[model samples]
Target: MKKFMNFGVLALLGMALTFGMTSCSDDDPDYSNVTPPTVELAKANISGMVTTIGGKPIAGAEVTAKLGSTTLSATTNADGEYTLEGLAENGTYTMTATASGKQSVTGSVTVNKGETAAWNTRLSNEATTVSVSQTEETSVEVVTETLENNEEARVTTVTVIPAAAVEEGEEIIVTPVYSTDYATTKAATTKDFMLMGINISCSNPNAVLKAPIKLTFDLTDDVIAQIKPMKEVNGSWVEAEVTEEGEKVVFTVDAFTTYSLFINATLNQNASTEAISFAQAEYDNLYGASEMSVGTATYTYKMGSEIGQHSNLLGAYLAEILAQQMAGSTVKTVNGSYEINVTLPIGTALTLSGKQAVETTSIAAGSTTVSGKSYGKVSVTANTYNRQHNGGTN
Candidate 1:
């Protein structure tokens, strides 16, 4: 009976041990904590009316939203409705709407989790107009009379010229006249401002100071006041004072005043008439007397006041002339690339020596046919200048 009791006790202990082991195994690593990435989802339903002050319905506008760096673009339907999909995490976004030849419309919208946001955009006046008015202001005009060596010079009485009507922020090209006898081919010089100053754009790369003698272009009053007692040295004019006042500067200049200018020119005994002879002589040897019709070629071209047309035409003319002068060369291709990553400038050709694919090329540049004789092939490559595509291949 004692042996039977020992067996029972051992059996009970084994059962308890087995239950403990099963509980430990059940507590193994649980993957329920490893959740999948939360995909943010949203949509945009935007609607708005665009009309002029006269209440004309403007159609076919484009609406866009910029959230952080990501952007969503959509175009308006004929009814002026736009819908966008696949928006990311909720955030505030800058919304903009635009149409051709119309002012752009803008607004903002805040999106929430799984929420569809509504936005409305309206556009206003989009045209730019300029008006010109002139104030009664003193003007200065200088005329050169004669010069007597470096010792004495006879300058005509300075006069006042009427201020012309100019639009605000417009550039006025002022040409200062100098006596024909004034020194030419000088080392460097400076000219002082005596009248008519205009403001300059600081960040404007187009704002520039240049000269024939001492002409001022787009001079502002603030610039003149700051640079008063202006002096010229080492070929450039330097302002004598600081006129910048806080963020705004005032430009003003005295009228009928004379500014001193120092020039570093070698006094040549030859006059301008003699200079023409030199021009004729140079051209005479190059193309003979026939090409020496060296008087001003007064052809009407697009340029500034001198040409009275578009200035871009001047550069186009030079490029065309250069191409025409090339001999025995037909532009096979203007731009060529071998590797997929390679690129070349327009009007440039790359010759592939070996193991390169052969591609046919074509041209569409505006060219005049002179009796089937091409002075030079004007190959206009795509994505280049204003000239039409002169050459290409499919």
Candidate 2:
């Protein structure tokens, strides 16, 4: 048996997804008018089958293939088979197969170019109970009831939620985020993305369940700005209204199926901060300015100005590097308030050389959080890269 779907959407629960980006560089000369390079890659083809834990094919089950910013879906045919093509090539992808009146099953998949990856999983009814035990430290052990034969089936540990029928305000699921990690600033909202949706089921399979359970997630305010809870149909996201209750984001999920949040990830926003100015100080040292032109960020900056440095946010750090690293010739900053339009590809580790100058600062110092992580500030004198940071190459 494969592992069940896990949302990892407990908001600031601290279970941050780790990023892995890779790139190459040279001596890299510093020159004005440096145009950072950009790369665009595509995924490959994939096929799969869907069935119930009882060994029956599920026709018309909605299957969605997601990787990076690309999402596509197709319905299973009468034979309970489906295929998703042109997915992100040579990277990790996730597939969710769901059907009406049945609990959805999600699984992880890896696809490489020219390789047709296959995904197969068993979906269980929301009310079915399967005994569970722990196998490996990272794996769950499950024992299922008899299938067509009287033989019981042993399965692996999967993410399971205990069953409960609610009269209305009890917490059905308590998703956690790293609450201790707070951000004074955020990645300039680059491109808005709908974080993937996931399915949750009761811990015990035999327990009866109902919808309208209150769901709460602990996330930071800036991240909350990028995403909202929603239901996934076919491959599109349908917005569902959610309420902000103090430190928690609360909403109602009607079924034991899949619920996804549309994360905005608004990198560059139209706003102002009290602590930062274009050039904070004169001794700040002179590094030529740079700009990331990805989306519609309508900000402006002056060359050779005392720009804010030793920043906390990666976007800010990225901007600082671009400014001084000869990525762009002219320096630029947001004139007043606007959005940023620079694009970074998904599914790769953005490895940058900090020379160990990356430090985490206190929340009061206008620190920014990247996936619940804090890096104090790179010294204005240190932290230089060899390349133009061409949006990170693969």
Candidate 3:
């Protein structure tokens, strides 16, 4: 009887323990049906300041950042500070800032995950000037002023308009678009050879002009000779007829949009010795010092120096020597330094014996040749050569 009671007690204890464990498990929370905690994703941001070209803070300026279809925007505070939040991380955004009475600026910035990228922009005051005219034919001189004190800086004149460009008794506004203000236009039209650029537009864009309008640009004759007038048409540049009017360049255009003076790179030159000499002097002046070597002797000179004054004579003598070599002739010179009057095509061989020699031959125009083994070759363009060498140490 004792053994039976012990076995029954052990069986009852085991069953109670299993039942308690089952109950506890059923009462516990159902984690499979409950929702899990959510985690926030990381994002990037862009911050910047907006100011005027003069460095003055621009309050209330609009700053925008765009990446594909997503666009974020912010406004500048009194301190010119702006913050664009919640941008896609590790992306490049095109940023643009704008303010009233100021030029808009655009740039690009990159942001990293959970970080703000800094961008800064400076807006320029509108450098364009507008004038109203009510005459049949009128002239407008557009002038740019210095930024510091608003003093007159550069002036470009537009003149000689027919009645068609502007209707009589109708007020028309003419605006001058400066390159500094319109950099894109300048870059597209001028490349690296721009001397001066002027943009002209009438209030009536559809006005049909019967005659061409004239423009006068402030430039020297030398500069005018090396450049040509170009007009912007449909976003492309086309050559316009240009003329030299005193120290200014005058060009006529049927339509007035943006006209510029660009150095003509393909311009052929029939340069005279005087012109070449002047150019050489100008180059020397710009670069401090320059030298020319002939026959193992080097001549060093600067602008306005004594040696510089003899550029024409030296150039002519060099040309004569080269011409003789090209024509299968020998050039003989004495040991002492002397001057010789050099005229082009001086009959093949030149014999210089410390005395002036005059010789003439027939050679092709605009032909430059170099031939010789004992003496290095010389290249010269002979158009009209008359060089006289007096007693000088050059």
Better of 1 and 2 by TM-score: 2
Clashing pairs in 3: 345-361, 346-359
lDDT per residue as tens, model 3, 325-383: 12212222212111123322221112211111122322111232222221111111211
Model-by-model lDDT, in order? 0.31, 0.38, 0.45
What are the models' TM-scores? 0.25, 0.27, 0.41
**Residue 170: error of model 1 in Å?**
1.2
**Per-residue alpha-carbon lDDT of candidate 2 for residues 158-196, written as tens digits (9 for 90 to 100):** 333334353222333322111001112222232323232
Clash counts for the predictions, in order = 22, 49, 2
lDDT of 1 by residue, 1-394 (tens): 9999999999999999999999988985432222212111223222333332222344677778788888988776554445555566568878887888665655576764333344543343332222212454333333321111211122222222223333334433322322111112221232221221221121223433221112232223322222243333333344433234342322233321223322221111111110001111111112122211222111110100000111232222212222211111121111111111223232222221111111121111123111111111111111111123232221
Best candidate per lDDT, number?
A: 3
Q: What C-alpha lDDT, on a 0 to 100 scale, does residue 209 get in candidate 1?
A: 24
Report the candidate with higher TM-score, 1 versus 3.
Answer: 3
lDDT of model 1, residue 75: 76
